[model samples]
Target: MAELLDNDDPRFAFAALKEYAANSGALLRSHIEAFGFSGLETVELDVNAAKGLGTLLASKRYAGLVLDRYYAHAAAKWLAAHPTLGRLTERAARSGAVDLLLREGDGTLTGDDLAQEILEDVLRTHAPNLTCRTALILVDPPASDAAAAQRERARSLRASLRALGIETALRVVDANRPGISLPEAPAAEPDLLLNASVFGTDAVFSDEPLFCERCEAAIPSENVEPKSAGGQRLPEPRLLVETAARPLRSHLLIEARRRGIPAVSGFELEVARARAVIEAFLGRPLRNCVSATIERDIRLEAENIVLIGMPGCGKTTIGKILAQRLMRRFVDVDELVAQHVGKFKARIYREEGEAFFREKETEAIRTLALKTGLIISTGGGSCLRPVNRALLGLNGRFIWLKRPLAKLATRDRPIAIARGVAALYEERAPIYSSLADRTIEVSSIDETVRAILGEHA
Candidate 1:
């Protein structure tokens, strides 16, 4: 396994990212943090609205590299090495690499839980970039107790940032779950060695590998079976001492002298974060960032953040974090259902038709502009209608709440209904994305919260 690097080193991956973009007309929008050096401009890309980075790529001569969004490490390496596909990317570069990165190529929506069907459709049939140089990589927890016990038994994101009270700072690992090891010899070393989020999981990528105490022995669900893909029994670590002891001790030593965090590994952190999520789901009081108030006016100073995403993506929880971090109030539109219909929000969905819920949602949308110092969380359906979106955009900073549809299994919200959840998510995702001024995928409540406060995210 590769090792994750600390930020102390000059982040060189981004330098390569910039060089590639400058060599060609391409520009990239990705979760991987850009370094201190500012490029030409920092404009938001509408990932939910459209597809086809070729035309976009053709437009710029700068050679910027987009962070591989969806695929895992093996896929990135394979695509990077493809003979014909690799040539096409080079041709695009020769043609004067106009576009840099396709931000949302990882999932359908950029950072929002907006529409993905159209974008996915285009990618499936028309994508020339599918086998391009960019590839998404996986960095999952190990199938062991180490994976489970660290950071209060939480995964990477939840463990590290949550302890710091960084709520909105959800971790977007560069590598995907059940991580793929990088192949020897392909592209040279990266210019910018930026590890976007603290850990490298399915949510993101980095030049170095990430270490999480939790992943040492925790086999991913897909790989839980004893039989391997090659018709053989796969190796399983019987003890943390053998599989994880060395790695854990090695990283632990570095962290101790360099920057030892309270958690065991990044993956362990995610599991620990479940505490905060559970608290939010139960409507518990929120925590503060350190003792100091960023500014009481932070709430007043904060522009409205309109959350858009598929169902069960933690919009409300993230909203709560943003509100707390900014020292503002939090609002969940679903909470109003009980006030409006004399029934709990879920019961309202059960008794009153979804249409009735929409009607009430519209009412909530209209009320946003009149208020300030509030972080508003809305239902996935709320962003579907143009009228509701218009109301949300009025002096609001539209943000997409992106998360894998699969993670819903761990959540207990009403939106976690089993059947057709993906379909419903597909239907509403694009609409939510269309309205977002900025998009951010919610990997964990901690990472999401950290982002709101403008920390290491």
Candidate 2:
């Protein structure tokens, strides 16, 4: 981090890394394993290491380093405990003390300034207009220390809100309880339900956690059938703020939006730390650009351009073009599957079976789903699985490339060959339609690309 701060150029820092490659290689591998990439061989270090390092060092703005979650959380606790210091920093921010903090790098100013910055963003529109007029912060910690820490964090937030003349109450609840209901309701529903708990972070297992998409009812994950999906009921408030970092459209947020509620993800609030750091470094306040940079980062980190359609519908072709135009990494799921199996898609189907091919496809999708900022082209039938659909939809914007069934080339496409092109199209078209966030009719490649770009813009 210091190296990057000194140079302010990713290329220069990366070159320094290569100079100390032996030491950096072991250090990088340890961090990589910590992020869940295990069993990495030393021989494949060049390719895998470069990819991992590039992912972190590609942007010199260094938002992730500046907006460190640990620092922000620590700052919140500090502000909660030190009311005098908090007031001083609040006055400092109001008086443009950017120069003091920038020149001194004082820890005292940094923490309070960061906490105040986050508060400013959150209260931009002021508090909610509910009868209760008090926000409820729900916390469920896994340990005693965690409980204490969460209490401090909540207290910090309460202190910040009090400064703005808003009232907040923190409640420690049991997460395993079947239903989330308050012991005694206020005059009306709480102004906001601040989910500082870890309940919704397990969204992948439950699919949703507020309301079912199809039935519009609260159904727990265990009670639903194997293939059926539903969500559990959460205490509703005028607004929901989840404090854990999640994808832009995690099932928790999706369910909230489906139920006509406004939700704020953790990613939105994390900008405060980065905003504070950048402003300190620049020696001036940024009126704009921080949010804009965050929005762009969202596009890069969580919103992928995913193309899906029948085989030979130009998904791969259009995906390549889109990848180049957008300057994103391109991934063809079919190619990834083939690489995993050491065989082509056609050969796999002919030798092993569709079931085996499908397994490999799911594996590829699962791996790719965990990443972001890619133009992904999926196989014709790969997305038919419910799991695959969920995985892709987690971090991607699906664009169905619609070409005439007759126009689709079927060369070496085993499924397209086995089932006639018309039959395959008829079977898969509805799924494509269901999953598509945007659909582009494949009249002209350039026109289709333009439509996708325009929609994104």
Candidate 3:
């Protein structure tokens, strides 16, 4: 984070990350939230593809990372062929654990520097929408023999997060073993025992907490989102969570629920502290810090979604479908001009010349971009104007609905006439690529609409 990009392509990391996030929603969301965030949503960035996400939210918000061992070591091992690691990477690639998010470095930095980068990124997004009372952390799966060294790195991260007004915890756990153990409850028996029988009798004995060699998966949590994959009800937060303390440390934590609390896993504690920080920063209770997914009596606000493409690339056709799906009105700039000027689009192009038409097109795109949130489609050349590109980029996302020229055979935009039809494809493809958060390859209006909604929905 302290060093600038040594190359001209500074957005390299951002671009790589956007692609990962776009495709792997479940993984990205889980890892980011685990790092301590109030809320997060992925967006198409005009930044680097290989870039990692870093935000300094408002003062008092918690920000940090919950990383795995693979992220810490793969860079040192695989020099040429490695991407960042995490749930998304695990599910998507499934080959190895690599860093899905990494700063621009030799990838051989000391753990302290790696920890610094993680804290910096999360804190960058921590203001206004976030409160300053947050902390960041770096979680590593137990891998290194140097436990003391790892602890020092974690300590450095904790100090940094605290400097940003966050309380932090760094942990390393053995993924292959039962998680770290703590003291027992007063009366409630430990769900996990080093070696216990079903009837609470000793099956076998060991100094370690009992872990079943037979069971493959960790027990599910009842309240975790999307429910359990096995559909089994999750037991209450026991073992790791204390039932004796006031105000729950977890399992649907709320100030009102704090009572007879117990211990919590490092991950759970980091999350709890992060949320608490957000609440304090916002001057609201922790219960109110997180956003709700439920629409809950929400009123629809008119929105503007402007589609920008070179020319004749199915903007009108796709725009109509997207608007219908969104239940918002649609306006095609070329069609709107034809309707207002009492002339066909081609007629206006021929009679008024390209310059005059471009002026009108620019004004229409500008106005449409500003109007609350209606969906608007622009002509192929609309993106040639920087204003149009900025409007689409800043106000909302840009979807470059495209296909091979073979797929666009009969499409007719102005560029089709002045130059050969192939020329249109050659000229605008790069700009379209630059302008879009995603380039959905579609052969028709319907497919294009589906792709757009697929991401937005």
Candidate 4:
């Protein structure tokens, strides 16, 4: 066995254990016992040894391999408590390769009917190609007449699935009975496993399979918008499996890791979280992808219509008309600054200084850039600040509303009155032209609106 092992070094003793287990068809406990250690103390195993054991167990060679009763229970508990293991279980369940729901409970399945309905709907919409095969595994079956009632409900669930063209099966197990055990993975594995029973029972410990809780009738919750797959309306792919016991959640996660499945903590499994798991499982993007696509469509209709150039270029008048025609929100950057400072723009510049006004103007532009579908009228010097220019450039389609120097507004405007329109134009014309997505020479307010609307259309 030593010579047959993959690694020759004694430091890799688990390599030898792997070779022995592969060839001899012995359980993991036997190998651990051979090494003079109780398999119950699995935590004592080094990280490499633990990983090696998990790898060996997951391999096809060791398929259907069973652990000793004590070791099996211990390993199941350990695996259930693992943190990162849940991700793999989630991945496998959402891959669209399998459509299974495993419900483990006593004879009475409280929410089985609702789960069946949801599963049927999911199959009809998103997974039309796949069969919805469900397994109702009854753990700790009740005594006598109650047992008969449980069987009836199971039959009803089976019938429901059948109506939807889903194959269904019912397995009754009495874990309390001496020597009897729960079914192992691969043989009895389902795509979605619902642990309706309390944790640490025979059902949860029996197989290292992914576990889910009862389905919420209104899952995907109110906040989540339904998405479309294959041109069919589908509820967001989310499994709302509730488990109150933290240890049980951990145990299921551990089983997922051992079996190379993705699992998420039931408490953390929201619509968004479930979508993320599905994305990981399918190896494609979902909600974010859909959002990006929608945003692209909106940009076509509502690209930021930014009006730029000299102070009296009729930007505010044209902006109002364009926004009304385009059905977008109208925003004047100078007005935003006035609102922010609780004073008029001229007052702010006179009392607080030109620098103070520019700071407020820049803040308004930065804040407004986060939104879309707007016609923005900016102050003459708003483009002078590179920060403001960058922020506006990100979301707005800059439109230079150019005007003759004499036509520029000089009355009541301090910059135009002080610097003169010719000086302001010399300084700002190049920046405005460089930044403009479209340059429209100002003729009349109606003409400007028509030109913008034509270009936008």
Candidate 5:
């Protein structure tokens, strides 16, 4: 039995004793007597009795004592009998490395709920020592929604631990499948196992040996059976003393910490709370990491200054001026669309149909959106499509160049000739208004350039 015990360290032995006692509802004195340390009650409160009890608890027999709950109470008594042992056990129990194993079952509780409950239980059961230490959260993947919620909860739990200065990691197990292999060795070995599974009985009976081998920690489960694989006995892992939660509320601050950003949740309250907590912990203002990332993306995306309006609205002339003033390359989306279809926009509309031309236009806009620091001039009806509007918005500051209907150029414009400038303007005015970040009523190219550059500056 002594050889069968996983850990030889007296501190782990004592902590295991207390855990066993708590679970089995056994008395500590009984375990001490069972371990062949008799007459503890009769022994006087002197150095000799304390010495004897310490030696016995620290002996090889103490290892065997942790293997069975029958010896748990006596182990607890051994700790109580010696003040130094009791204190040492308490500290080890609190600060030691903990591995949590969660089982999957037909329970109404979500994975997150189960995780919260188990974490709370572990923290409450083992505190101070368990606080600010590494924890590995393992659970069987649940149903789609439940799994998503569980991942979210795990993310929150990680954040909460970081807030408390604890390092944490998460892993999902397929418990129903046998011979599940770990991706890689864990960063650190755990000191204790919290088996929070519905199939707790089966896991303890069949899996304890493997778990003990990998973790060198005691399984805090009531069910236990001898390890046998294909009529062959298995050996336990090397045990040593050197080894090694809250409702894990996810505040917005936790999300920000995870993203290395500020205001990730987008809700004012959550962002405020996250900001305050992070600032206090970091002892400085929360850097706008998210904003910085977006700015970087914008730079990469090459968001150009885009001018849009009807054909005769002086978009080309104004676009070139704006480009020169801003020292950016100028591009005409209409020309790009023409190049894509291997013909002019009017020819594509006439030959292939308006739908094909619209597709070409959309493709051109998407390509243009990937460019940065440019001045773009768009055709009359580009803002009509919601997709084009969205794509352009992502990479450009949109400005609609508005001109009176009578002055609009309809000579080479097929759409203007077919639909008439007044009708086109009436039809697209609302879309242009909706899409443009800013609108400049066109007076001249110079004035328009100033307005656009003023906004840019």
Candidate 6:
């Protein structure tokens, strides 16, 4: 099995994960079976760490090479000489998979070229059975030369798709343009949207901005305001492919999921490429599905759990319990508002009024939405505004905790007290149902926790 990489060493993160099934618990009472895997280990590394990659490759034990688009061409010359890969290339030629060989250029083949090659290979190999007829390539134009290069790349991609019997269209947009409106789709909406844009990839990872700062100036998602052309909403593509590896950091990915569009992360493509190379080196297929497992693991570790419902529906209580059990930080939007106001929620309602309290709530939610891996409990009325809903829903799985109105504790909750429990429930029930990703009845607290865990598991 290929080993998982540590981020500290540039070569550490190149593992092709294999799933193995094993029986547990010897002849015990009611022999229970279970699944297990190693934990993810994330370490930070810089561009200089690429030196370690060369040193590691010299060891010869690591035959497979999978690199980021930016670094692919940098090591292409050395990679072309791999004895195992050379043998595999001969086999691939005999089998008529001509593109299997690593193509070289006169030091002109760039990271973009390698990325395009990988994209083509992935389409030809894995999604060969796809029935999608239309594709749109959205480019983020930099300089005039870069823009032209991107256009040429898109044209090449279009030709590749055409060879696969899929008609494709190209759409280039200025990612920097304010209030950018994407061009309307043709008679039929595009089946796939290939975001070759820098929207997600340009942002600086604050903790590790040494590399990012050398590229483009960082743009926060809050600054990007993309709207559909005209007054109507842009048609959602069936599949969205972000060329950026870190989809979680992208606003585009968040918006895509919220609109029910299926997305493919650029990292998935990298993993697929790595898996293929590793399988070739091993001379046998690995017993694992790359995309689904990686996607699930990333989501399970990074996504936030949000509890939203009536004022006294046990969101806070259950959220605390869930957070403790799952080992995630617990955040209460109500407490955030109170912390900002320097008073209790009811005091804020009485002294500063509801508008002031809501403003604080929105500010808090906006900040928290940018973070990940938290268990959040919202103020009963916090998600009433669409912006709040968007902020929280961007990275959270909202769960509605439903309980009998009479059973709810309404002592300190001014809103629930002023507005009768029945009346408030009648007003907010529909919104809760609409916004919740999962709805769990508040039976016993333990049962409710189990239900939430089961949903996530």
Give the top-scoring candidate (TM-score): 2
Q: Which lDDT tens digits does candidate 1 get at residues 328-411?
A: 678887776567667877777677767788778777666664354467888767776655554454335667878887775434
How high is the CA lDDT of each candidate model? Answer: 0.38, 0.58, 0.40, 0.47, 0.45, 0.56
Measured against the true structure, the TM-scores of the candidates, in listed sequence, are: 0.34, 0.65, 0.37, 0.39, 0.40, 0.65
Of models 2 and 3, which has the larger lDDT?
Answer: 2
How many pairs of residues collide in each model? 97, 0, 73, 18, 13, 2
Let me know the TM-score candidate 3 reaches against the reference structure.
0.37
RMSD of each: 21.7, 9.9, 22.6, 26.4, 25.1, 10.6
lDDT of 4 by residue, 278-375 (tens): 23223355456653443344344435778898988888899988888878899999999999889988899899999788878877876776455688
Error of 1 at 135 (Å): 51
Q: Candidate 5 — number of clashing residue pairs?
A: 13
Residue-wise lDDT of candidate 6 within 281-352, one digit each (tens)? 334655667435643655665578889999998999999999999989999999998888799888999999
* The 10-residue segment with the lowest total lDDT in model 2: 95-104
Q: Where does model 1 exceed 4 Å of error?
A: 1-302, 409-419, 455-457
lDDT: the better of candidates 4 and 5? 4
Model 6: lDDT of residue 351:
97
The numbered model that scores best in lDDT is 2
Error of 3 at 364 (Å): 1.0
Alpha-carbon deviation at 152 in model 1, angstroms? 65
Which residue ranges in model 6 land beyond 4 Å of their true spot? Answer: 1-65, 73-132, 143-170, 174-189, 198-238, 245-284, 289-295
lDDT, ranked from best to worst: 2, 6, 4, 5, 3, 1
Q: Write the per-residue lDDT of candidate 3 for residues 169-255, one digit (tens) a residue.
A: 332333234343222121122231110001101111111222222223322221122222332112222222211111111122211
Which of candidates 3 and 5 reaches a greater lDDT? 5
TM-score of 5: 0.40
Model 5 agreement with the true structure over 80-140: per-residue lDDT tens digits: 4444333223321232211111112321111112122234433444445553365554444
